[model samples]
Target chain A: MSPNVKHRERNRRAARWLLGLSLVAALFFGVRVGLDMVYWNDPKHHEQQLEPWMTIGYVARSWMLDPRKLRDALALEPVPDRKTSLGHLARQQNIDFETYALRVMDVIARQKAATE
Target chain B: MTEVALEWLPVYGLPVLVLIIGLGCLGAPAPASLTLLICGSLIAAGDFSGAQVYVTSLVAAIFFDHAGYAVGRWGGARLAHWRIPLMDRARHMLKTRGGMAVFLTRWLLAPLGPGVNYMAGVVAMPLRRFTPFDIAGEVVWVTLYLGLGYVFGSYVSQISEVLGDITGFLAFAVLAWLLWRFIRSDLKR
Candidate 1:
């Protein structure tokens, strides 16, 4: 084949390869979107998982508890003007964040149990 | 980096938010949408004010978009002598579908927003035209992500993941379509 014809043939092959790659990527992300929808839609997923970054107010909202009631239950000091995350609360209490989170989670569980 | 930013958000608040949005708009990799989602959750939890987050984020996005555009305009002039095929294609796309491209990239295809801004400036899309479409699109972008977070406060992370996947799917779908068209045209030739 002439050089020009050979160049055209090569371009065609490259274009087919790119098209195949794009289709595969589209399918991968499409499946992920489907799986995420299914997982989040399950009733068990309705409950928010606690994270160290969450503030007391955020956790209270997630758990459907009154922030003040939750704070009083935790026996935390008066609310500071600035919003404080669970990590910050742990630091002030001189405890590890995980331990502090567990203590807070226990209070939440008890409160939920009482309400039920 | 995202973890650190999320942790600092409740403590540092708006400054952190502004920095993230600004960097993201300037084509730096940042989780601006996720931050906006968390801001919505924070507002719902009463740690932040809805109006404040909305206005601050919107302003920051627009300002940084303009900054990206200015950089593109400056650099594009210097690079004008170079005959880059990709630049030519981008210029043609802007000429044909500038408004819709600007609008869609702002929200529905947010990952493309910064690049579109630069291309729009590189092609010298009128500031008058660019401003209205940009502002309108940003309004939708800010409101949609933040509203979802507000309405589904506890599910912000899950929602972010789903949104990311959806965006990726759509991007690849479009790429596939364009590639198919190119192949067909080449075959015909």
Candidate 2:
């Protein structure tokens, strides 16, 4: 075979391998996207995980609690600002963040029990 | 670092966003998208105003993109002088397709955005051309993620995961198509 023919053959083989790899990758990610969308849309997965990043309002919305009710339940004296996160609040109050988070969680649980 | 950035977001607000988004634009491994999503949720929760988040993030992204470009231009100045065929082809590709590359990578193929910025600079793409596309793409990126977070609220993490997968899928699908095209053209030749 001429050099040009050999070069074309090599390019053809490389393209086939690359295309095969790309197909596999595309399929994998496509399947993952579908699975994630299904998982995300399920009501069972709707429960929000409470974290240090959550503000009072975020927690209130996530748990379907009235923001005013949560504020009153937490007895945030002077009312923590709208943007104040539970972790930041804990820091200001000289409490460990986990302890403060647990306290907030407890408050939520009790409030849910009362409403139910 | 991602967790620390997320945890500090509510405490520090826009400044945290500004810092992370800027760093992400400059090719840092920051969770800039997640920050934007959480900020959108915060906006929904009334912790932040939409205008502030939009304006701050857009500016930070554009500013840092230019900063990345400047770094690339400065650092790659010597490399640009090399007469490699690959470099020449890359320069040609950037001249022809750099706008679309800049725009798509900004939002749709976002993981490549920083690298594209650097490459555009290395190829000495015109600033005037780069700026408009960069701004347009960043606007779409900022708006899309923030909008999803705002609308989805508590599901932001899951939404992020799904969006990430979709981006991966699109990238690989495009690669597959390009490879197929190359094969067809090679056969013709």
Best by TM-score: 1
Q: Across residues A21-67, which tens digit of lDDT does each residue of candidate 2 receive?
A: 98999999999988887886788987766776788889888788898
Q: Against the hidden true structure, what lDDT does model 1 obtain? A: 0.83
lDDT of 1 by residue, A3-108 (tens): 7777667767877897899899889999999898788679998776776668889999899887888989877766773498887778778998779888998999
CAPRI rating of model 1: medium
lDDT of 1 by residue, B70-168 (tens): 988888776544444334545766788888888988887776788788878878888988889999998998999999988888878878888988877
Native-to-model Cα distance after best TM-score fit, residue B121 in candidate 2, in Å: 0.2
| Cα distance off (Å), candidate 1, residue B164 | 1.1
DockQ winner among the candidates? 1
Query: Scoring each candidate complex against the real one, what DockQ results?
Result: 0.57, 0.52
**Tens digit per residue, CA lDDT, model 2, B39-123:** 9999998888899889999999999999999988999898777554335645876899889888998888776688888989898
* Fnat for every candidate: 0.74, 0.78
Q: What is the interface RMSD of candidate 1, in Å?
A: 2.6
